[model samples]
Target: MKYAVIRFPGSNCDWDMYYVLRDQLKVEPIFVDYRETNLPIDVVAVIVPGGFSYGDYLRSGAIARFAPIMEDIKKFAEAGNPVLGVCNGFQILTEAHLLPGGLRKNQHLEFICQQQDLFVQNNQTTFSNQFKPGEKVMMPVAHGDGNYYCDDVTLQQLRTHNQIVLTYSKNPNGSVADIAGIVNEQGNVMGMMPHPERASELVLGGTDGLRLFQSVVTRQLQK
Candidate 1:
């Protein structure tokens, strides 16, 4: 399956995601510039990889949300095309209004980088289809504004809609209810702080993240 990896000026993980797709998964990722308003129609999935977009100036992903490519990205996601955003990419999705809630500074006010565990909260979505509900997987996380927050009513709505995708097994970032990742209402868009691409290879770390990407490609082939 064809995957698109978007690159903004300060996006550092674009190449890492590309390598994971091309070298590890043997799928060539389409490199998309942040300014490109058009997207490749044939691409099956789009991934907004991590890094400090716009140098995380005002807020993480605050400025990058307005990048030209985001228009098409939003369109594709709205049409139910699978979209995954990691780290600052997650922040971007929230800022772009593609996903619910928002990210804020860690309660402790520090950047965190460590291997973390995430509970598979919603396995029905294409992004987490391979994992069993309640299962936990190890993935690395690096970020400052990883704290997720939403009001009580919205949190209830999210739970009712099964929008919570992954939850921190250990409450690493003080995210509300330990929410580490979430999916859109349609289950087409997902945003998470952990770096799944970083865990796709056993040599690099582990293969827990392989299934997330593989599931998208596999579903596209079935279609």
Candidate 2:
């Protein structure tokens, strides 16, 4: 299956995600420029990789949310196809209202970049099925706006629906409820502050993140 990697101006991690999916995961990677209005016909999954889009002008992803490609992504996601957004991509997903909640500046008001410990809160979802339930994994998080926040009612709804998929073992960004990643209510779309593409290879210090991509492949193969 083909995976579409959306590339906006200033997207540094787009190549990283492309490499992992194309080389390591053994899938076709189609780079979709932000200005494009359509995804490739064979694309089965969409990936919005992390980076400073539009130079992070108004807000992290505020401007990029209006990009033409996002409308196609929104429709793809609504069709129950898997969509994974990392860091700035996560911010974009929320800004576009594809995912609930929003990411704000880190509590300490500084950019953080490091290996982070994360617990898989739910492994049954499309993006995390390769992981064991409650598994602890390490992924790199690099961002200034990674603190996730939602109101009480939304938090409770996330809890009630098991939409919370990953949480920091030791909260680093002061995210509400220690949430590091979450899926949508339908569970096909996921957004996270961590950069799984950076951690997907052993040469990159760990292979924990490879399973996330593998999970998506496995899910597709089963269908």
Candidate 3:
């Protein structure tokens, strides 16, 4: 299976995610430029890395949604291919309608950059397969527009489907119900505000984030 990581003009974490998949996880990484109209035919999965795309001008991810490649990304996701969106990538997913809900400014209206404790909510999906439900893990998050919002009814549906993947242990961003990450109904698409790639190296802090990338490779092997 081939792994493709999207690269937008202002993407800064693209290389970090690329290294995580290539050097750390030992997977061949394909960087897909945002200008490209299509994903490689063999691409079996994708990672939309974090960064202030288009400088977050018209609002985070607002302009990126119109990129020609976004349409293909959505179609690829609908075909059940694994899709992981991190930070600004999460914003893009919401903007592109691949994931439900929107990410607004942090409750404090400040850019928060620090390690956050997260509790695993659901480990049944491809993205969380390596984790145990309710387990605590620490990952770094850096963003201003990280608060997640959605209607109460949609939130209830998310709960009913067990779609919530992770919850902030300390509610750092004031997201509803303290949600930190979530998966689509099909479980192939997931969006999280944390920078898992930043924590993939033990020397930096912990390798807890490595499993997330491994989860993708493991799931591919299962198929």
Candidate 4:
């Protein structure tokens, strides 16, 4: 299974994500330049790793969403391939319209970095299939614009559809409904504020994030 990690100017976690795939997961992940026009056809999955893309110039992920590679990434996602967006990557997915809602500055307007416990809300999605519903997983999160917001009806719709994949055990960013992650309608795409890649290895403190990647591999192989 081929994976592509999109890299933008200020994307700092690409290497961490790469190493997680290559060394830990033993899957080769291509580093695709955000400026690249065409994507390799064999790319079956794409991860929009975290980092302050474009230094969060105009808004986190607002500018990076327009990168040349996004068109191909959109095409890949539309074709039912799994697309996992982490942290700023989650913001980009929202900006790209792959996911609903937008991430806003923390209600407290401060950058928060700590280990958070996330409750798995839905396991049907390819991203969270390895987790049982209501399971709590620990992962590190570092961001300022991790507050998720949407209209009341939209939030209701998401809950009704089981679109919410994860929720923070405690309100960390004051996100509406405590949403920490959500998947698209098709379930092929997911956007989350927590850094799963950062928690993939035991050295990182916990392996709660490993199941996310493993879930993708498991589902892909089943197909």
Q: Rank the candidates by TM-score, best first.
A: 2, 3, 4, 1
Q: Report per-prediction Cα RMSD to one decimal.
A: 1.0, 0.6, 0.7, 0.8
User: What TM-scores do the predictions have?
Assistant: 0.97, 0.99, 0.99, 0.98
Model 4 poorest 10 in a row by lDDT: 19-28
- The TM-score of candidate 3 is 0.99
lDDT, candidates in the order shown: 0.91, 0.95, 0.91, 0.92
For model 1, how does the per-residue alpha-carbon lDDT over 147-205 read when each residue is reduced to its tens digit? 99999988998999999989998887789999999998898899999999889988868
Q: Write the per-residue lDDT of candidate 4 for residues 47-156, one digit (tens) a residue.
A: 99999999999999999989999998999989999999999999999999999999999999999999999999999889988999899999999999999999988898
- When 1 and 3 are scored with TM-score, the better candidate is 3
| Pairs with steric clashes in candidate 1 | none
Q: Which scores higher on TM-score, 2 or 4?
A: 2
Error of 1 at 10 (Å): 0.6
Candidate that would win on lDDT? 2
C-alpha displacement of 21 in model 3, angstroms?
0.5
Scored by lDDT, model 3 comes in at 0.91
lDDT of 3 by residue, 1-223 (tens): 5789999989999999888888998878899999999999999899999999999998999999899889899999999999999999999999998889999999999999999999999988998889887899999999999999999988998999999999999988889999999998888999999988998998879977888788888899899
Q: Which runs in model 1 stand beyond 4 Å of their true positions?
A: none
Please report the TM-score between candidate 2 and the true structure.
0.99
Model 2 Cα lDDT, one tens digit per residue, 1-223? 8999999988999999999998999999989999999888899999999999999998999999999999999999999999999999999999999999999999999999999999999999999999999999999999999999999999999999999999999999999999999999999999999998998989999999999999999999999
Residue 91, model 4: lDDT of 96
